[model samples]
Target: MKHLLSTHDLDVPTVAAIMNVADHMSEINARSVPKVPALLGRTVASVFFEDSTRTRVSFETAAKRLSADTMSFSASTSSVNKGESIRDTIETLSAIGVDAFVVRHASSGVPVSVTEWTDASVVNAGDGWHQHPTQALLDAYTITRELGTGNTLAGVRVAIVGDIKHSRVARSNIDLFARLGARVTLVAPGMLLPAGLAGPGITVTDALDDVLPDVEVLYMLRVQRERMDAGLLPVGGEYSARFGLDERRARMLSGDAIVMHPGPMNRGIEMVMDPAELPGSRILAQVRNGVSVRMAVLFRLLGDGQLGA
Candidate 1:
């Protein structure tokens, strides 16, 4: 647990430990001040090479909540624009006595590479079609909270729908859910799915209707239009009609089944049913849980390991 590069690096006990710490972190967030001295005097640096809204702000908020000093680095304004190398930039940040780096890069493995350049622990915010470990952590936390399933996901069936080829969230979720004892079904068109994704605790399919009735969690992904240069489908409507979680498809869900989306949602494309209005939607819950999960991660990596012990 020195660095959170991917969910694949975590086993069941470790995941449960993080979730337990996150439970306490969530309680702290519910207090009037919502601030703690757990990480006081520590400094966290957020370095994002790619565009972000939720993750960047969430990490900054998490750091602040734990009373950690924070600084932000955007590639557009940093020495990166002047062609400074990644290693050099990290070395410079390390010189400033940063305790941890919450890094998001357009290239896969940049965060892992950053670990070698600095003594600071690295939390991967995201990387190119790779893993978003924190996102998956928060998502799992959200599901456990809402479903009252505690920290274990045994026998829970989860279906991740759409854009599997380009979604780092999907990749991380599949790994996390499997490790936590959940059955994961990746639902996407054949062209959108990666090769060799189906085995063991995982399944793959293109037909959403067949899987909808049995799954307890329906996780929808936004169509990554930025990743799709050429048209992956004939038209948006056709895709939406077939794959999108519209009102009609929403009804197909099993009783007590929850809906989820890692957002910047496509209103009429990947999600026609308003996530906010959906009865069982955990979309906003995921956002709120993100702060707590990240706080737990920071505390685990930077603070004494007594929180969940």
Candidate 2:
């Protein structure tokens, strides 16, 4: 694959290959120095049109860990604020010899469009409510690590909860989990789910409590209040009441089950209780693994595209 645009573009072997590379990256991250010369002299630029803390910092750290040079871009402070187009910004950076770009935009397909303006390989960090490939990668890695079931998530019961209609993470995970042979159930209010969302090995439900006991991975999603229509959630209290992962609902999870959440969370709304109290919570693990997953992606795209080569 020339570009990491969406999970829809990946098959099983490609996913496994990337995750194997992540295993190598994860080892590097565990070392005292946590540094490598794999990507020395190569430049990876982060061009983000949206605000982010985890993804932006995570990608920068990943590139640095591999000894790749990183360029940071913020739309608010860049020429974008001065009316320069995205094409101009990307072209400008490409002219300076960027080897790869980690692009995140509030608009869907921005990364795909960026490919036209630059010769560098492009990785979609997150775009609109379309896809967040790297997040899904880390999540799958964390799950597979926990299960000790090797690379595939086959037969794993994963319930992705909350704001499905507006979650790029949810969309990416559903495709990936299904590809890896996992059973995925989307838990949300009816309107939160996309209309006619269906696929093999996929399930949908509005009842979180009913889905809780059965799923091995209970993934909580941030409720995107900004993306919702007015009536979908009034006051946010009701949604929390029904779908939030409170202590009581968390107890429904079986022993050895795990809880996950993609970050910058809506604490009171998406999760009524602190994740610290949850026995098998993988939220911090997800963040820790994110850097390694991103490092693997950068290696695959910008380096020789081989593991341990």
Candidate 3:
């Protein structure tokens, strides 16, 4: 729990502890004075090398809720525009007393490299296709809340639909969900799915229909057009025609099945179904839980660790 670079870095007990803390963090929203003094003297730095709205603001809210001071830095207007290298930027930030770094970088493993340069605890907000640990954590919290207590998704089948090749969220969710005792089924076209990603408890398949009926959770991912280096699909219409989760496909789920998407969804591309209107859609809850889950993470990493103890 020292650093959250990847979901692969956390064991089952630590992951559960963080989730329990998030449950307590959620309760703070109900209090007359919600703010905690846990991170009173600490400081967190959010360094974004890519564009963001939700992730950045949620982490900022999380830090502030715990009474931690934050230094928000984005590469778009910073020394990065002056041709300053990431190394120099790290050195500059290190000159200030930064307690933790919540980093979102375009290149994979950049957060791990940041850890090498500073004593700050590194939480990988995202690192290209490498991982987004907190995103996975929030999604886990959302599912647990929806299912209620003593409801472990041990044998529950989950189908992660849509883009997989360039999604750090998808990669992190797959690993984290498996670790939390869910059976993960990855469904995407051959070109869209990552190669050599299968393991014992996980299965990779292009047959979406086969995976649909049995899935307890149908997680959709947005196709990242910004991350594309070359032409993978002919067109959006063609891609959707072949693989999108349309209304017909949405009907395949069981009565208690839930539909999920990490936001900024593409209407007709990855998910043809109206995710917001779906009864089982917990997308908005994922966004709210992002703040609480991150609050839990910040408190654990920077706080006194007695909030949920």
Candidate 4:
């Protein structure tokens, strides 16, 4: 509960606690003003080495809602452009009395390193292909809210389809969903599956149809084109054609099954999902939950529920 570096570090109770707080935060969003002074004197520093819009803005808005001052330091305009190290930037920010840090780096373990170097508690927005803990939590919250209690994963099947090798979201969700009692199936072409992935009650498959009928949720991830050049994923249209979840694939699921995609969705690359259509789509819901979920995270990390009240 100290620093959220990875989902693997959180026990089931800790995850449940955060989700409960997120439910409280969801209630706050329905209020007239939707602002609190719980973190009035506190400050949150965001150090984003990677390009992002949703995660960064969500954290900023969350801190603001709690009345915490926010400082955003990205690679483009910072001393990082001058070749300054992450350690130097972290120390500089920490010396200024930051209460917490929300970091997203291109390299895995950077958040963990930041936690070691600074007194500020660190929340990992993302780290390479490692984890996006907050995203996983929000997705979990969305599922719980939609399905209600006892609707956890126990007998429900979930298919996480797309670039698993480069998807930090997939990695985090895989762990989180499994921990919450869901049966997870990671579907992707051979090269896209993460190396050394096994156990923890997950099944790996290249065939979409194999897991479709039983799946209650189809979680899609955008294929990382950048990883193709780096050799982590294969190139081309053929790969997507074979694996992408189009209308045809969408029809294969149960009538009540839901479809979810974390934003910056590849309209044609990941799936042929039309934003205007798709009845059970929860993509927009994820964005809305991001604000409330992040608000809960900031409130808890800052040591009070008043901020989100």
Could you say which candidate leads in lDDT? 2
The residue-by-residue lDDT of candidate 4 on 1-309, one tens digit each, is 567788886667666677777787778777898888878989999999998988999999999988999999999989899999999999999998899999999999999999788988899999998899999988887877766753255655788888887889999999889888888899988877767777777899988876877888888887777776687655556656777777777778888888888888777777665855877688888888888888888888787522222
Off by more than 4 A, model 3: 149-152, 226-229, 304-309
- Report residue 109 deviation for candidate 1 (angstroms): 0.7
Candidate 1's TM-score: 0.96
lDDT of candidate 2 over 230-291, digit per residue (tens): 66653477888888989999889999899999897788988899888889899999998999
Candidate 3 or 4, higher lDDT?
A: 3
Which should have the higher lDDT, number 2 or number 4?
2
Q: For candidate 3, what is the total of clashing residue pairs?
A: 0
The global C-alpha lDDT for each of the candidates, from Candidate 1 onward, is 0.88, 0.89, 0.83, 0.82
**Which parts of model 1 are misplaced by more than 4 Å?**
305-309
Model 4 misplaced stretches (Cα beyond 4 Å): 229-236, 304-309
Order the candidates by lDDT, highest first — what do you get?
A: 2, 1, 3, 4
lDDT (Cα) of model 1: 0.88
**Overall local distance difference test of candidate 4:** 0.82
After superposing all C-alphas onto the true structure, candidate 1 shows an RMSD in angstroms of 1.6
Which of candidates 1 and 4 is the stronger one according to lDDT? 1
Q: How far is candidate 2 from the true structure (C-alpha RMSD, Å)?
A: 1.7
Alpha-carbon deviation at 308 in model 1, angstroms: 9.2
TM-score of each: 0.96, 0.97, 0.93, 0.93
